[model samples]
Target: MQKKSIQNKDSLKRFVDKGINEKELSPFDPPDAYNPLNIETIPYEKMHPFLKELIDEHKNFAEVLSKFETALMNWKNNNWIFNDEIDIGLKQFFNFFDEKVPLHNQKEEKKLFPLLHKKLIEIGEHNSVDSSITGINLMEDEHLKVAQAVAIVFNFLELGSQLPDKRSREITFELAYEQGMAIIETMKLHIFREENILFPQAMKLLSKEKLDDFN
Candidate 1:
């Protein structure tokens, strides 16, 4: 009985040691496929290259917006010690909107929307004998509204960058946070509508030839 008890104790100690070693191993040291950030977006399997490209761009914008939000949180948590950092992050977000987002949106507005609308009309899903309102018009209206809301956030950040005092910095950061969240909320819905509604309608309604042209 004593010998058996000793053996069981040794086995238990080994298990405990193994558990300790595993816990001590850096959780941050993960393989690339582990995806520590947990990127959660809609799965768009087997889409046209053009639509896929737009989806990828939207995903990139979301990531950048996430970073900007993190910067704002950090600045707020640390008594606004990182005011300049917030400005830097905000600039990155705005530049993405200015330099990249507009062109991506324009591609949809100029190429994707017109082509998709014509195809949807032919199929009689939109601009029909009974229903004249098209998905294209809805998306375009959303684009204008999203652009305006995003512009407000950008302007707030730009003005906040020139804040001269801690009080002003705090006040401006608070205002920017509210405006930024509103913009993100609206933009996220706009993106969802496009990805879920508009893009899918295009994929389903348009022919292989038309999709090839867009690509």
Candidate 2:
């Protein structure tokens, strides 16, 4: 049995290597394969997977924001230098908002936020959650505001290429830099509230049945 297990592991490792090391690794999925809904089908002894995914995405956004800021700094240092490299970097930042942020927000609004609200209500602490900041409605409102802010930044970056003069391009980039920083700062505080206050309370209050229902 031990030998068979070892052989199986070796085979799995070989498969992963071939998939990754080869040029055809276009649509790869991880072996441990996390889907938050899987938590419903399994035992709830350690249901940190989904929550961790959400938090990890927040960390990823932080990294993207950092890159955006760095790219802006480079452009500024280069005497209002606008180049293909800087454009690519700024486009990546815009794409992060376009493609990733919405999906991340969906997971929270559709899954985690609802679960948090349910738990708060069940534990008779619904009133304790600040309706202005941390409540589902308030959080959703903030999401909308953030989305609008992101759109403004996206347009600024997008229009930069079409602007006729270098001066116009530089001004647009500067505006984008400020807007992107503000949005990232707001999101950081929002994430802090969720991680420190909301997630802990939900973990304490959430029941096995609720976990099952999430699946």
Candidate 3:
């Protein structure tokens, strides 16, 4: 009994060390063999251009966010501040990311989701149709949360025009930077959920014949 308990404890420890929980591993897997960008099963070379573009865009944004976060952290710690031009650049980037990016997502939610739901029903599965509708609605709600947070960042940055000194600029910069970072984190998880969970399900339901007309 003692030996069995020791082995079980070791097994659990190994699982934790390997990050082998169902929630962690399941999200990384694709719904089916048709998805070329399924990271767990497919190599990068095998990915279609569309899927490659999607992944590349997400990764590039993540890199930019990391750089901005680092700059903000350094500013906070060492007081190595930025000039007006840098402040303006940061504000512009936040505005573009928050405003323009969500338009693409809104397009997906408004146009794509209903069409996808219809396609699933045409394929003869009521369950799939219902599931897609529910899932896509939830995803759009998440997008709304991120968009609202981003609007707050944009509004705060606009107040920079009223800032009197470099000290106030620094303070405003930090606030905008933190708000943008929070929104970026939400956007990252949103991308992960869509690409990993939603898109694969879509691909499985949407046949080549059905997608050809849209393409």
Which candidate's TM-score is highest?
1
Query: Which regions in candidate 2 have their CA more than 4 angstroms from the true location?
Result: 1-47, 121-134, 165-169
lDDT of 2 by residue, 1-215 (tens): 11122112221111112223444220111232221111223223444666667778888988887777777777777865678877777778888888999999998888778767665455443323232222455467668878997888778877976898989898887787777766766566566545655555556667656645554
Number of backbone collisions per candidate, in order?
0, 0, 0
Residue-level lDDT tens digits of model 3 in 67-151: 5556555545656355654555465557557665665565566645676656644644232323333445556666677667667
**What would the per-residue lDDT of candidate 1 be over residues 56-79, giving only the tens digit for each residue?**
999998898887777767766876
* Residue 79 displacement in candidate 3 (angstroms): 4.4
Where in model 1 is the C-alpha error above 4 Å?
A: 1-43, 78-81, 121-130, 160-172
Q: Which ten residues in a row have the lowest lDDT in candidate 1?
A: 9-18
Estimated TM-score per prediction? Answer: 0.66, 0.64, 0.57
> How many angstroms is residue 121 displaced in model 2 relative to the true structure, after the best TM-score fit?
4.9
Assess candidate 1 and give its TM-score to the true structure.
0.66
Q: Rate the local accuracy (lDDT) of all candidates.
A: 0.63, 0.60, 0.53
